[model samples]
Target: MAENDSFHHVLRGLGPQVEHRGEVIVIGLGRFGSSLGRTLVDMGHEVLGLDLDEQRVAEHSDSLTHVAEVDTTNVKALRQLGVGDATTVVVCIGADVESSVLTTAAVADLEVPNIWAKAMTEPHGRILARVGAHNVVFPEAEMGSRVAHLVTGGLLEYVALDDDFALVEMVAPDAIVGVPLGESNLRADHRVTIVCVKPSESGFTYADRDTVLDPSDIVVVAGHRSDLERFADR
Candidate 1:
């Protein structure tokens, strides 16, 4: 796997970086919300988990910095819980579109510095954005797209920088093996740039124009998604 991919996997397994530790309030204790709260707490941040379900609140109480059973859609109830004071708020009521929108609006009304929400669809995401969510996540859709890329790209790992650009790791193609990068003219031919090369038996190294690629070498490239796909096809 690529270094970036490994880094992301580590974050999922443990938590985010601790550099921005602060008070975070996560409303709705569903799987995604609970996971976010737990990860935040594990990263040394103070995470407060809120949910309408008493059982869910109870289940995450020990893992989080704080847990409360509250109606997130109620502005008065949110105010009483000091929701406005949170540095960051994550609304995770994705299953219920109404609740998600209402909760996001309420948090935004509180003037929280950062608000992240989960949406089930594009329209839902747009609604959340219009209501004041700083970031909207579509877990299922994003995962499905990632799986599709993995299955079709024949790549060791892939990370999208944006809709058009991506970083990908793959084995050196037979046509490129034993050839110097300068002579290959990969950038001119495929519109992709080799960022790094990881030898099967050793660590990673920067790819220079004169670097010779071997069949066993794994190369990390960056370029537009279409360009990378074309390059990988070879």
Candidate 2:
């Protein structure tokens, strides 16, 4: 091609850097998806966000690489918006299973490299999985424990390292009292690592595994969600 032709070709694709940095298309600019888009943009990756609400799109204009108002139920409109070119397409729509299904199927039909769909229920998750979603995120169910913890004041903090991994801090319950860390075998049996132990009583040193668990000792642990839930129960 001639130089002028090449220059014109580049100009034609001038809107966003969808091809560079591995494009990510996030449908539904709701709370979860909006946060995800902002994080990706902050990381210097390209993100294209779509939502049915124009106000939501406008709200994220500063945080996302690109934002457009579109009804994801229309697969053709999704294609026109370049959903097919995305390296990863995430559907973050909640509550409406039909819209979620349509969007999930649209992305899959476009053959996006990865499709991640957020589900509100176990049945929703199974449906997304059946439609070839690379991963199904059950945000409500996954974070349900936090609500209980917050109400009871038993949890000091919650940090999600990833979809399945978490770091939690909680007051040690009566059951773990008098048990040494080494004997508890938290790492061996549950794959949970105790990063720190803060005793309710003063002048307590929790530097080694030989340290015995005391009532009301604040424990910080890193583990999978299930293991953490079980640990919290104990």
Candidate 3:
């Protein structure tokens, strides 16, 4: 077998045999984990954060519902801490690929319904998925791409719907101003869709045919990345 395949084969049985149960479990307490755990708490979901570091556990104790310094690599430690009961589990271990994979496998062994893991590279992400992670996120890579778009364009906000599709928020360009949106032919001329708009006086609302926009008005446009970039360049 290939070297990489052999490595995965050895990791396959690393998770301890354990039966199910947890609400929302977050493993690792680094920057990403802390941010994600706090956000989940802010959103009203109880999160159980597990980390091997005592200092980290103490640091985030107040931010999340529960924070513990438990060896996440051990299935018994996790189960004893109630991690097996998690309905949703997000492993945010960054840098340490071994712990990340092992912890994820352990979570998967528990048969958690939803598993989200953070991966630094494609290979790392693949291992995470192979170990049964339901979702894998590349936070740093995604953010880097997003920041690249922001720095290169006039976009106020950019959200990628997928590799090729994007939603952009930007100021009304001079070319599209001084006319009702319906008469502007933006769809035909710019090949973008105006889903919503925020005029100088109000909050964002669904844009309509009769919507007339002034310069500096914020507009939310959705389309392929290339089309949005081209329109933004205008």
Candidate 4:
């Protein structure tokens, strides 16, 4: 087997085992939070949902293990609802940044093991991270980035590693056809690595120096944003 194949084989042999069996608390009953809680329930996890709207609580009662009409930002209410000891708490209040921050901090003060929050902007995202949130998500901006990739037809998938770096996977344009990985020296020349070169018919083959590019092949590369932007014909 090739080196990359052996690497993937070893990774596949490792199992992802769940280490805890506690309830999950989800604050906010809006579109994002409600859907997330429902997915967790479908996965056989005990989910407790909290929202200020009584109507929402009633509407989703059947889908949740427990539902409460409580102001999630209120520390007393959050604690009374048993949110502090939840295995994980996800704060999905996007409409109000203050409320999201308050609830996220409340969960952290309560010592919840995992806290996930949604932020409205770059600053908000950074604040959430600094305040001890395990993960801060920018849903709107992220979706917009994905949409931009789709609009640019040559672009397949673009995953941001940081503000300036991205890993892009795309169908190699006609200009780069027939070039071998070694000759392109994507890593040395462009500071990008062609990790996976997947033919139209096969799933994927780990790219190597000798790997030849085909017109129908899809290449998954990790590198700076500038290189991928230029390669995508952007």
Best by lDDT: 3
Query: For residues 145-166, what per-residue lDDT tens digits would candidate 1 score against the true structure?
Result: 7778879977888887666788
Query: Better model by TM-score, 1 or 4?
Result: 1
Residue 155 local lDDT, model 2? 61
Worst 10 residues of 4 by lDDT: 9-18
Identify the superior model by TM-score, candidate 3 or candidate 4.
3
Ranking by lDDT: 3, 1, 4, 2
How many clashes in each structure? 0, 0, 7, 0
Question: How does model 2 fare in lDDT?
Answer: 0.76
Q: Which portions of model 1 miss their true places by more than 4 Å?
A: 1-21, 202-205
- Residue 126 in model 4: shift from native, Å? 5.8
Candidate 4 residue lDDT tens string, 127-169: 6655657777777878798778668657778777665677778
Clashing residue pairs for model 2: none
lDDT of 2 by residue, 1-234 (tens): 775443332222221233333778889998899988989888888898999998999999888988999988787998899887777888999878999988898888888766778888766766776675767777776578557655654567887665578788887756556877777777777778887788776643444678787786888878998788777776
Q: Can you give the lDDT of residue 66 in candidate 2?
A: 87
Among these predictions, the greatest TM-score belongs to 3
Tell me the spans in candidate 2 whose CA falls farther than 4 Å from its real position: 1-21, 149-153, 158-167, 171-192, 196-219, 222-234
lDDT of 1 at 118: 83
